[model samples]
Target: MAPSSNLLNTQIDDIVKTVLEDATGDVYMVNPSRDAIEDFVSVATADDDDLPTVHMLADERTLKDVMDDFIVASNAADLIDAGRLELRTIEEAPENSLLVTDDAVVAIVHAADRVGGLVADDEEFVSATVETYAGRWDDAEPFSLRTPPITRVRNTLSEEISPEAEDDFTTILGSLETARGDGDGLDEVTISLLFAARNEALLYDISKWGEDVGIASKATFSRTKTKLEDMGLIDTEKVPIDVGRPRLRLKIGDERLADADNGQLATVAQSMLN
Candidate 1:
């Protein structure tokens, strides 16, 4: 899509790129919806080194919605730590969504099912909009995201475990955008089990590592493991440890999963899941 199109044919990504292309300094995004935030963040972070800093002010509910998606939340946290993005939470829902730069303002328009943008460069309108949102940004409380950066997760997993496991992790993440609770896709726990089965890793080790890295709880991992096993996507063997209970080692239970590569594991698993 052309960045110049600001009519009904334009989407959020087009507007974001158009505004960022001419941005002089920091850009302020006011009250973008969850979908708008996803589009903006994906575009901004794709080549963040050249883009100006972005300050986003959204309501608590929107912030929470972004945080619930693992991919966006992790990427946003990475950008926040790198000083490329800033986030703040407002109390009430906003009436308008806007992208404000020093000299121009892009008003995001939502009509029925279509979305577009209107760029305004008039000094009076730009100044008023910037000033109003600048005050709101100053007063809004900072929103914190607890999800670890995906880069760190991948790096630490490679260092702490086998490279094969990390490879599977990366491939699984690449296969989907969100990690959990979208209803149409597999969740993090399911992904973890599939990767563990791919590597024939001990359930205790994978679950422990997952918990330590804040992916999910061990009990949740156990439940997910049982569910996958029942679905025939994963099978486990009792590994006799000279300790409390014999730990289970995960393996691919079906020929389809066993033959699929790391990149295809998530797709194969999702098909089985459905």
Candidate 2:
């Protein structure tokens, strides 16, 4: 890619890749979109040999958007834990987005139809951009993410519980990514209940596992289970226990749910929810 003072009509991911490829040291990103950050992390994580440290300053809203999605949040957390990424938040973000590196400075351009960027390699421009954003990076507040690494969650679920549950959990995550809205998407707890229902697992066992893994509290899982039951998506049957109350075994309630495969379960449940 040639150095351009003017915006080029190209994909944001491509521009990010080009700029990152030329970077000599650490990079600074100013107010990148969720998609841009995803692209950046994808490139950074893919390259095992040279993982340059990335300093990101984004708005609180954009950070929340990233954190709300299980897959994105978990991936970002993994990078942070590995010291490959540093994420921070600001109260208000500047109008333009930028990626500053020793090699060049790329200004992210948002068009009505697509995203683009302007790459500048002039010494003075690159130096000034770096100085300004580096200062902002120092002043910004660091973001603390609570989501666990996805690899850990997947491995633990498969090891501690059943592999079938882990597979269903992954399928539901894929579905939720393309789902319409926040309310329309099934959350972590709901997905856990769906997994338990699919496997006919005991509620106490799944909820306890969830709490232990830092996914959610047992009470939270119970509430979601009740909500799912009321929505006719799942049914619970009592199993006799030697001690106090009987344990509940989860099962698919609706005929549609029972018939749907793991891939279609989230879609069917979302339709029912709507």
* lDDT for each candidate structure: 0.82, 0.81
Q: Evaluate model 1: give its lDDT.
A: 0.82
lDDT of 2: 0.81
Model 1 scores worst on lDDT over the 10 consecutive residues at 1-10
User: Once all C-alphas are superposed, what RMSD does model 2 give against the true structure?
Assistant: 2.6
RMSD over all Cα atoms, model 1: 2.8
The TM-score that candidate 1 achieves is 0.89
Residue-by-residue lDDT tens digits, candidate 2, 2-52: 344545777877877777666778889888988887777667666766656
Model 2, residue 71: what's the lDDT? 64
Q: Candidate 2 — which residues are off by over 4 angstroms?
A: 1-7, 41-50, 178-181
Q: Residue by residue across 1-274, what tens digits does model 1's lDDT show?
A: 1134454567888778788887887889888988889998788779745787889988888789778888788788778878878989877646878888888888898888778787777789878878888888899899888887777777777877678899888888888867665676677778878888888999998888888887888999999899899989999999998879998999999999988887787778788887
